[model samples]
Target: MSETATVFNQQLAARSAGGSTDAPPPVRHVCVVGGGTAGWMTALMLATTAYGPRLKVTVLESPQVGIIGVGEGSTPWLRGFFDGLGIEESEWMPACNATYKSGITFEGWSTKPGFQRYFHPFASMLDNMTMHQFVDNVHARLEGADVHAHPDRFFVAAALARQGRGPRARPNFPFDIWYGYHFDATLLGQFLAAKALERGVQHLQRHVTQVQLNEQGDIAHLQLDGGEPLAADFFVDCTGFASLLIGKALQTPFVSYAENLFNDAAIAMPTPLGGPIESQTVSTALRHGWAWKIPLSNRHGNGYVYSSAHCSADEAETELRRHLGLLDADVPARHLKMRVGRMENQWSRNCVAVGLSQGFIEPLEATALLFVQRTAAALVEALEQGDLGPAAQQRFNDSMRTRFENTRDYIVAHYKTNSRTDTDYWRANAENMRLSESLQGVLMTWLSRKPLAAGLKAGRFGGGYPIVSWYALLAGMGIFPDPRELQPPTSHQARHRLDAVDDFVARSATNFPDHRELLAAIPPRVGDKTLQLYLW
Candidate 1:
């Protein structure tokens, strides 16, 4: 406490970054809490890094708290995630009961009731200039020219999904053809777990009973259900909404954006497969909420997301059944609770949270798994930089925050852009919806029928529609561009390109056999239909 000592300490702290007297902390061994898609994703990604030898990764999960097996529709970025995991698409696709998804069929969100059917097809199906022409044609239609006829007709995914077809990738179209998938979340977790285990990632099948922190508030160790202590250098909290380590142990604050996003309750169910599920996901808006029908190979994943403040769980469940025209006795249902927001800091101290622990937006656009992929990518990038210092952590956290905000904005844009004024929920949203600042700007440019740059405001975790994508949604939803004409592409010199496009569709119709056939070819695992667990 001497004056000289105090001055020396002050000078030392002032000389360091963040004005701290301590040296930058080093991250090596990472302890991942919970073992669903996110936990294993983090482990798998970290294990692949050269830093894996110096840094050990372990996941603590109780077989009791099972994974939330809901997320079915994903953006195209998932292909990159599978590729990063070195998973062969042919091998894993069938094991997970995945069906190719081109885009989503949006229904009942317009001002006019029966005329509400529209398609927000994938962005990769249009060239930059062609998108502008599409936008111009949309404007021409508003002026009574019938320039577009049906925008969805041009969307390869939309056309294919109408009759249940996948896409045929050809070199001529190149970047203009985009597709994703609808799959079972639990099976995906098992698939990833198997891959992680194969890659030498340790998995502990135990629930964390208590977190023991050092005097510095860093997690020194974790107490298992049976009183055994597990220790690691860094921690990842993927324990769903419980947020066991980050929120409970680290005391990280959650920043809820409920004012901007209203839906908070969902009733999820998997129905026996038999419908118009070709290669697309369907989201239909009901009176009180929205219902999603995601087609996996074996079954259809259906859910109704609604505002708890406006409707009861039973009411939402009933609405979902009514929309899909199903009987409750025929299918059981599971209800899920959610808060629409993100953690104030995704990575706090030495712990990072992914999946529901990091944030949960209602399944409107299905960004949950995308969150897992992006979070894992960011963590891997940070670790690959060699040290998880304060600078690195802050950089990673800020980028994730931006990504979450962008996602929130884009999802909000869907609600705000809707012209629906049917019920209290729709009317209220149409009247008082607030948009994120970035989306406000995007909407402005989008109103002009201009394609948005893919990586526009997203720092790292941004993945959704590309340029052609934004144009598709805007035009599909009846948003038109200014009268100023947009020039078409000059690159297609070969007249056969049009024929090639038709050929692509013709082949995609019969390509890859059927979903069930694909599943039959894969080796049986647990509840796979090939195991004779259920009747076809």
Candidate 2:
């Protein structure tokens, strides 16, 4: 056996000496490599402890290594994550130039002649009987209704976004909200880093040039670009695609999901909008790829993700510019070359790979940032139980893999079920495409509008969003699971609910604040400059 492997096993044995029945030793030092959102998030969460002094966290990030700054959309789970960290939105909003993102607008996917779009709104009305009744009314329209009509009219965010409004915490609401945000990813990394450092986590400014394995096959230490080595009992790999520790040193094989997901490259550009900023993200499909328009308080984050095998980067850039005609000159265009896959093991030996180090599933639904937050949360939870012993490490690995697969399945579902044949990219979906077992089953049951089977195990991380979110996207894409089985509301109920919704939507538009106006509410910071990072 390799000397490194031997060392790894020995360390595992020492850590697991207490046996499966006893609580494992506390993690004394955690070395996190990479300082992007993933790295800082891991450090911040891991440094905080119910055990208090049981954990000590350190982050190594290159002052020069730029991060891929493209993801601007997120799910509502972010609010909970921030709350868990005891972070006030106002503390970081100005520094990040953030804006509220209620949901995504999927445009140009239908069998009809002209492209049709639908809003996959954030909050569902299933909680309120009146809203549920309204949804029942809309369900009728969904049954045999005018398919070209905007089904999103029934959604709160879609309606409020149309009026360019943001969300405010309403005490009278049935549920708080279903909202996320659009911000500069690089800025967010810096914001998290500052917070992490303030909370007693050590930050090292250096690039990892080499990862050394000890005699037992575990990561023993990593050498910096031009400095001494840093070692720790546990390591969290957030080094983006380099996967220096997990993939290179630990030699964990990667499981590709390329066949199921088509788009491989993305071209991103940021454009500053001076007018009233919109508080919604719009994802429109093109002939060969898809384009995302994420609105921020100060600017719009736009990108085109395409299959590089089908089209060149130059062509994609031109296409993106054509779509965004009024783009500013200062908004330089950049390209992100990526793969859609996950590592065979996210947590292997004494190391765990998070963010792009583990793998990337493209930036379709903005799962990248949220994935980091969730992974950090899971790691924190596991560490709180004790150190990353074999059992805990295995559980962590399983959970990360499950989350990646779930995200991959959902992204693949979007492309595989697309009925549009406008271009070669769209036609790719028509081919006999492979699907994960979970996605395959979802596709099958979608034909009947049946809910997911009870006792569904989320495996690793909780599935992003829920099956219902998929149902909305599928229905909007014209991939009716069971059109005949769809229920419609009664006549009187339908009319009454529609009228109430119309009134509610109208009132919401009038009352809601504009995106830029909300940002202006923030107290101005002296010498606040926007941070930019380049990801090649």
Candidate 3:
């Protein structure tokens, strides 16, 4: 293994070890409200990460509230999250009905011929050569040169998905490939709650009736529905959209993203796993918005995310049913309202907002849990540094604001450059002038055929998406010159393709196993007491 990867692996394996004991932490007791994936994730991270020994973590789960059993998609950061917690894939995958996800395949977003669908794959070691060529072709096509620029041909992840392959490489394979997962979110939350309990985190079940604040306008305590008041030195609000602590108690201002992102609601319906499992999510464009088909090990998760301003609940469900070919199927669909925005301050005096309390940018890119992990990790770093004052809080707030805006810009870009004008929803998105300066720069750079790397700086613009993602997304949507006004490529590889990218990706894919066989071998871990499920 390479020295960097070796060191990274070691650090990730040792991530749960407590911090130095030389100095005392500011807060000794921490209480996390709510108990779904967000709450348990926060509680587990606090109970295991730095200052863990010095901290007393308590999770207050409401007995009256039930968990939303919606399936979820993820980015590769989730791998690091489980790794940091010292949890193995075998322990959680089967327990959560999980499936490996290489990337997302977008379908019917464009009206242009041969551009109706494209695959956006995760970057891997094999893309070192093909990605440069893909970028060159994108630039060449920008100047009206005929070239193959579809990203699916350049990355190995798409090939893996196409061949129904999982991401786990053989022991002899020297390189690591990044991957995500599609799983039952509620089951994962239950598993995480058990893991947190194993690590000395207290779990209490009660309904929070009200959030009480101190004289200084900070959260003082929480009053339970039928129990005594509970107080803690610090608070974490994971109360989904209710925002019990940070929103109600502290009254932090909210910053809306309605202008940038228009989707305000969603309808989720899970159907039985119909056939052999594929390792990619399929996102198809609909009239009002987009629909997602995420394949899990046990079933298929289908949903439509649309704007209520242009479409109603029934209208969205009907469109989704038509898309899924289940117009009259006996499947029940659950409707949900989305608050598409972020809080002005994620952290306010002695309390931090995590998960939905922090804010939501929608589920387009599956960044909901990612931001939750980010907030928890940032809290860990701040507490490890022993800085809990106003200055530290402002720094945390400012940093998170930039991250949210950057991620929002990426999602907004997906809507802005869309070629679909079939409905008023898409037409308005195309004509929408509300854009961040950074987004404007990215679009201008693509238009001018400048190196996208120049526009997307390393850290500032690439919140979770790298420069290659911007290239893939823009090029995937057919945001380039028409093929008719094109010339043959003078590039050497395009002429005489000795050792082609396709061959390389195909060869690399051999190192991985079949998706179905791999998942089938994982004996169900849901019944295992080590990671017990929460019986509601």
Candidate 4:
């Protein structure tokens, strides 16, 4: 046998004999490479979980490497992460220039242009009703009843967003709305790092010069520049696109989603808050791709994601500036190249890749941080399941793969269903973009019927976007079947439901505080106990 294979066998034999090894060391220490939003988030979650006291987590970050701080929009699941970490909104919102995000508003995606718009609200699309009720409402609309209104009108969150209002402070109406945040990513990373440190996570400022692998091809140690080699039982690659530990050292293969999702680059910049902070993220479809306008407390995070194959960087930047009415403004636009795919295995051997290191599928839906958060949460679950063996690794990889592909399919659906053919980019995306088999099935199913909760109960990931999200996108893009196809409801029932929704929207708009006013009302700082009680 070869020397390496023989050594590996000898080590296994010694481990089996328990001469110097015991229970495979129990994953006592974890080393994280490259600290950013992903790095700090992983460290903080792992260091604060039930297993925190048993594991020692250390972060190796270099000051030279800069961060891409343009990921400001987030989904509602972020609130769960914050609450689980015992972090109150008042603690991080001010520090990160955050503003409440009710949901995303899509504009000009249909062929009939005149700035057509729709909202994908964070609230459940349907009230406490069954699919039969939804089908009846659609049929009633077909029978000359004025039961038709935009889907957002039924959601209190969307209604508040329309009125430039934030959440209400009603004691009895706690579950009436849902919200997330738009915050500076760099500031969020710094905030999470401080929390992790306070929870006993070690922070190191050093660059990883080389990664050393064991005989069995697992990460054994990481060599730092002008320092000793750092050893750990497990490693997390938060090294962004470089993917030092998982991609380079562990040799995990990457699977590209370029064919299904075409936008591969973005030019981002922050502008001064031009108006009152809007409670929703505005994603306007542009000629080449789309532009995101995320309103924060102090500034607007703006970016144009476009296909590099269709438009040159100069042209894209010009179009973005023109759209923003900053034709001659001297703001610097930072260009970013996106790798539109995920690694074949997020957890290979003893290394787990997080955030941009694992994969990226553009920022169309603000999915980068969601992926990071899910991966970190999955890692904790895997670690808690005894030793980090092959079974745990396989399960983690499968779960992460499901999350990434599910997100990719959702983003691809946006381009595939868009009816705008004004530009070559849109035409190509609508005609030539490849669809995954799963998404193809979904589209086919929706053509015959509306998406039902039972139809989407088996989503690959645990906490993925729900069926309501699919309904919003499909109905908003004008892809649903004729209302005549569904079962009909009595005229009295249809009128009652429609009037109820209108009444709810009117009351919500009247009661909620203006977006800016609510933000200003929040105390600059509050103790944890007070903030918890206030939010809870």
**Best model per TM-score:** 3
lDDT tens digits by residue: candidate 2, 1-536: 21222322333354457422244436678899988888987787776644334567889887778887667777766765665555777888778978888777888766633326777766633223233443344344445543222346555677667777776433233333356788888888889899989978998888788889989898888898776899898899998998888998899999877786777889888776766677778888887888998877667888899998889998888889889883435558888888678889888888888899988888877888767776776776676566567888778788778778888877777787778776877787766457667777676655544434331334322155453465457656765423455445455434554566666666655545665666667432222121211100
Kindly report which residue stretches of model 4 are placed more than 4 angstroms away from their true locations once superposed: 1-25, 113-115, 124-126, 129-149, 458-463, 480-497, 523-536
Q: Compute the lDDT of residue 406 as modeled in candidate 1.
A: 70
Q: How accurate is candidate 1 locally (lDDT)?
A: 0.68
* lDDT-sorted candidate list, best first: 3, 4, 2, 1
Supply candidate 1's per-residue lDDT for 234.
83
Off by over 4 Å in 1: 1-26, 52-54, 113-115, 125-129, 139-146, 170-176, 275-277, 444-465, 480-536
What C-alpha lDDT do the candidate models reach, one value each? 0.68, 0.69, 0.81, 0.75
Q: For model 3, what is the alpha-carbon lDDT of residue 243? A: 85
Q: How accurate is candidate 2 locally (lDDT)?
A: 0.69
Q: Pick the candidate with the highest lDDT.
A: 3
Stretches of candidate 2 off by over 4 Å are 1-25, 111-115, 124-131, 134-150, 170-175, 326-331, 448-464, 480-497, 508-511, 522-536
Backbone atom clashes (below 3 Å) for every candidate: 3, 14, 0, 0
Ten-residue stretch with the least lDDT total in model 1: 527-536
Ranking by TM-score: 3, 4, 2, 1
Candidate 3, 176-280: lDDT as tens digits: 567789999989998998898998999998888888888988778889887689999999988888887888778899899998799999999988887668889
How do the residues 1-536 of candidate 4 rate in per-residue lDDT, one tens digit apiece? 11222333343355456543333336789988888899998998767544445689999898878877779988766766775555778788889988998889998887532226778877532243322344445334434344453456556666777888875434434334556789999899899899889989999998788899889888888888886799998899999998888888888899999887888899997888976678999999998899999999988999999999999999999999999999999999999998889999998888889999999988878888878877887776566556578887887788888888788888888888888878888998889537777787777766645434445676522125565577667666756334355344455746456566677667656766788887876633122211111110
Which has the better TM-score: candidate 3, or candidate 4?
3
How do the predictions measure up, each by TM-score? Answer: 0.81, 0.84, 0.92, 0.87
